[model samples]
Target: MDSFKHMHEWRQNIDRFFGESFWNEFDSILKPNIPQINIYRKDYEILCVINIPGIQQIKQIRCEIDGYHLRLQGEIELPAKGYELIQEEIIQGSFNRAIELPYRCREDKVHARYEHGLVFVKLYKDVHDSNKSKTISIEEGEQ
Candidate 1:
């Protein structure tokens, strides 16, 4: 009876080893990259916070928002280059990430600020009244 119990538990463990969660964990360890980001949404606006370390200059980062998509591009420059790399968990080099926001944002009202090692972005949501209707005049194309 004890032998049968052991076999059952072993089979369960083997099944778990081949599960999606197990593979995801293994994949992250093998290729640990990309900056971590958190986003919050409200009726009027959306807020995004990005975690970036070892940033030398704020000018190195660039952010743009078009429609519902936001793109981030930056690099983390190593302070000392001569020393042999022993262990590195922090990802360096130029990284770009594009995220689609839940709501359509007003590009003209987008604001961004970088402080310490985190970037804060505030995007205002576009306001459109469903009951209102308007007509647009067609424009002739330039020759």
Candidate 2:
């Protein structure tokens, strides 16, 4: 029968290529690739915005604050050869994002910036000391 129909179509193409690479690495580890944030509150100050995209310089981005959390580390560089990544929901390498400061901020008056690719933080709302918490100072911003 023609070599058993070419071994059943090569075992159905090796089970559809390992079932699409095991659901694309189980949906990128249950979904979590960082980059994509937006905190509100304006006036007393408490804004944040992140959306880094394949950063190449700018010290690979890095910020930190402690009074309710506000950390962000970066690294999204991947594409050194003839591209071909069909569909990848942004997220290339090392990334760590954190934001949680409804109040209690003023780690030395935080303020960051990083145009275009986005990353404009600005916290300063101790509002008469809401149980202060320190750990700041991460400059380098503007344009």
Tell me each candidate's RMSD, in Å, in order. 11.9, 12.1
| Model 1 lDDT tens row, 3-57 | 9999988867976888636646665577655677899988798998877777766
Where does candidate 2 stray beyond 4 Å? 1-36, 59-80, 91-110, 113-120, 123-143
Q: Candidates' TM-scores?
A: 0.63, 0.29
lDDT to native, each model:
0.70, 0.72
Indicate the worst ten consecutive residues by lDDT in candidate 1: 134-143
Q: Which stretches of candidate 1 lie over 4 Å from their true place?
A: 1-33, 128-143
Alpha-carbon deviation at 34 in model 2, angstroms: 14
